[model samples]
Target: MPTKGMSPVSFSPSRASPSPSPSPSHHSPSSSPPTPRKTLSSSMIAENVDTAESIIRKWSVEDGSSSYCRLDSVFANDRTEAKDFLRSVKNIQSAMQFFVSEGTSSSSEQLVRAQKLMQMAMKRLQKEFHRILSSNRNNLDPESVSSRSSVSMSDFEDYEVASEEDDIQVTGNSVHEIVAGDSVSDLAMADLKAIADSMISSGYSKECMKIYKLVRKSILDENLYYLGVEKLSLSQIQKLDWDMVEGKIKSWLNAVKTAVKTLFLGERILCDVVFSTSPKISESCFAEIARDNAVTLFSFPEHVAKYKKLSPEKMFRLLDIYDSITDLWTEIESIFSFDSTSAVRSQAVNSLTKLGESVRAMLLDFETAIQKEGSKAPIQGGGVHPLTRYVMNYVGFLSDYSGTLSDILSDSPQNTRSPLPESYFSSPTCDDGSTSALSVRLAWLILVVLCKLDAKAEQYKDVALSYLFLANNLNYAVSKVRKSNLKLLLGEEWIENHEATLKQYTANYERMGWSKVLTSLPEENPTAEISPLEAREFFRRFNSGFEEAYKKQMSWVVPDARLRDEIKVSLAMKLVPAYTSFYNKYRGFFGREVGVVEPVVRYAPDDLGNYLSDLFYGTGAGSGSVSSSVSSSGRKVR
Candidate 1:
């Protein structure tokens, strides 16, 4: 029971929704510089009008469609103007049908005034057409005119255009001419066809709106001409036609493509259509159309291959698209079928649940897409890629819609959450403070990503490079997790675990690189071999080993300045004391050969201490400043 006694969801029997009237599309003004203008000529105007008429005539099935005459011709060579001219022609005919039936049309002041105005405007244009045709009027006799219906000025007084019609005729000729004489039903049907064509052409921008208006205007005119029913039944009057249905589908497809491809505008249009007030159209009809559209938008991409092909911008790039679709779709129920008393949001809940499933499907496909690429060219052993950042960012947004993901996992038999430590998610560093399933799930995803990154690090062949790669990636993940709301779910335990992992990587690096050199020093036994040559040889190996290690290792990267400093100190603690003591004991034993008084040691023990402290300090790694750093390390080593 539609509250407004509007017609039953009316549609044309033979054609799609009313043929779209030629009309300008709704357009936002361009910010770019103005396009160059082109001049309009009579010939261009005539050609365009001919083209426009052919399009309408081919589509409009009304009995006297061609007789519904004279759309204002577009003369300007300007493209926009040409289009407007074509639309104007359709609009003029729409007005013409209503104008003819005005004497018997509805009593609504607004509708009546609008029809009267169009009639008057046409009269003015007709006067102009006459001015142009005046020189040629001498060639035609009163009865010779075949295309127009002739009436005397007195006989045509009912339309209030007798004076205007008189101007188009020969001087004192009795005939006042009108171009058409279509019945209300025929005119209404014709207008419907044209309106549908227009909508298909540019209707979705505001279809529920423009179509309703055209229908209302025609109804007012139709009522004046013949007995019209208050309750309009689409099926009652004519079989609901396939052409109308196809037109609607075409418009929907176009809208879906627009929304799917964009950053935002298509979503806005969809939202507006979903919520527009159409008192004349049946709610059930609108709902069915909307549902159909939703199906087209979210369906079709069933598996990995299809989803991948539909959306090539995977990982983070799809977030904006995901957001617009999910958010707008979720709100449909609230807008369309909201129930105040029930706890359930009648249609929206189910709609959203389905929407959630659709999104989850697409996301699963995204994993397939990324993994496919990963198989071909494995993730590099470095910090997170920009694509990864975008994926994480989108997940952060998806946190708001976590229920959708939660629903997907509901069927799992195993307890999804890990047995938590008492301090899990409790610490400031890790806890997002949310205890919901979505929070836990998001936290789980974060851990999974970290594990994947760790595996990527293992790809590097160099043990030292592997450690550096791990350090860089782990550091980035830590920073992002800390900054994101994912922190709330990540909990203190996850943080503690990752932090411990970082320390282990650091320790591995220190042991492999710095510890080997520290262990190579000679024992400090007093009874052991003490020859100057033995001491010299030990110094020689130490010099060669330490210098090579220092030079080779210094340039190796450590990206985080704080972490780099910490590593330098930890290695220095192990190396500085041993080197210094060995130097002290050996310096007295190794005397200069012959008169060459050059120092036997290239660097004093103090230099060793300073050099250890400066290791892994910058992006370029000490920048040939090993000697300078030794001076700055705990012991002065000039």
Candidate 2:
């Protein structure tokens, strides 16, 4: 069955179907007709068109609208029909574009109609192009399969249906590109210089300084060369313009210098707004702002030192400035006893504590520097320099603040049952004998003062104990000096007076019927013995007769009556028994004669016997003469 010159082709289920076998009747006249290659001719195209038409007809019937109406109209051959056909094509093209762009592709009918509409629009465009050409132009053939395969179907679909307005470039393409060897450091420095210039022109020297800081951070030492050139270039260009950033910085420095001078002179009005307005606001707000500004000033010690080099007088002036501000704080503290609100009180306390800390730090620095300098020289008598004197004054102001803060805390309700906070108690002290660096010590002293004023015996005791401990543990170098000074300042009378005061208070408390002292007594004290019978008798008598007498007396003492009959009767009844008991006990103890008593015989003189009998057992009214004789005899016996 194989023909000559025909190569056999094998069939496999997985492989694409081999081209349809050529017909045997069309054999070549040579040894064997060359095997005819299988091709899809126009007849196959016609068959596909028929199938597609059939599918469109079924879809129209099922979908209730003919999606192929435009195709049908285009093939129709009348002028009126052709006009309608073109219009239909335009409508179909518009609808298909909308469906492709906005509608989902899950529906088979929508996808088919969209594809068909696109294909028809392309053919119309080709035909229009052909019509525009002259007759001498070569006929343009339909796209070949190879050429068509080169163009992606999805790309063609998008081009035909996508709206031009929706074509937006992605960020990847729109971003500014940085070329090779372009230094970001140089660019950033230039930007900063420009910002600094603008700020200067706008009268914002402080802001310009901030911009310079940012620029410094952006450029490292390794990239300084590049940034320096950029900065020089910018500076040159700005010089011809209105840029005065450098001038403004110098002006700022001058202003700072003036402020330092003013502060040194004790002029508070020239201080920063935060410092000047602090006393007028709530304690907390004042404290927070003051602390923040103080930190800003003291954060850079080296910078401050460099600034001081502008003038030796400026260095001394800086010390005066701190002293003046601290003095202001002292005055403010003196005006307010204690802030009523807790938050405000806390702020006030914290502010005072921070102020003390700052003063201490500054004093320590000055003291260290002075000591170092003094050690190298032949400074006699350990005399303080002018700077040291200013530091000491500043320290005194700190002590005053500390005292005020302690007073405030002592008056606070939260601190009622607790010891003073360590911040209040543990402030640093100067070893100098004077009260120069005595803020912490003076705070304790103030506590003692308050205790003395209020007569708080227990608090005084605690304070004395704490002070004694502190004095004893002081550094050996200053212990003797400080202790002597402390004794002198406190006086010998203080110790004796406090002891006497404590005793008086204790005695008063005891006399006021306070029984807590009985329990508080040392266990070594002897306990008194009491019989149960006696105790019961005493309590029973007290509960009965004592209560009745008290009520009767209390009731009988009425207005306008000197004495009431009932009261007199109650008083007699109550006193008679006590008097009788006292007489009986006294007589029993001392009435018996110590010497030997002679026995009285019945034979004794009748008068003496009668007299004795009357004295011993005289219930009846004794004759006045007999009673007088008996009294005379008793006196003779004594």
Best by TM-score: 1
lDDT of 1 by residue, 463-544 (tens): 7666766776676666666676656656556767788988998888776665547656775552355787877776776766
> How many residue pairs clash per model?
34, 2
Q: Give lDDT: candidate 1, residue 120.
A: 35
Models 1 onward score TM values of 0.44, 0.16
Candidate 1 CA-lDDT value: 0.43
Residues 289-312, model 2: lDDT tens digits: 233222222222222322312322
Local distance difference test scores for all models:
0.43, 0.29
Compared to the true structure, candidate 1 yields what TM-score?
0.44
At residue 120, candidate 2 shows an lDDT of 40
Looking at model 2, report the run of 10 residues with the lowest lDDT sum: 136-145
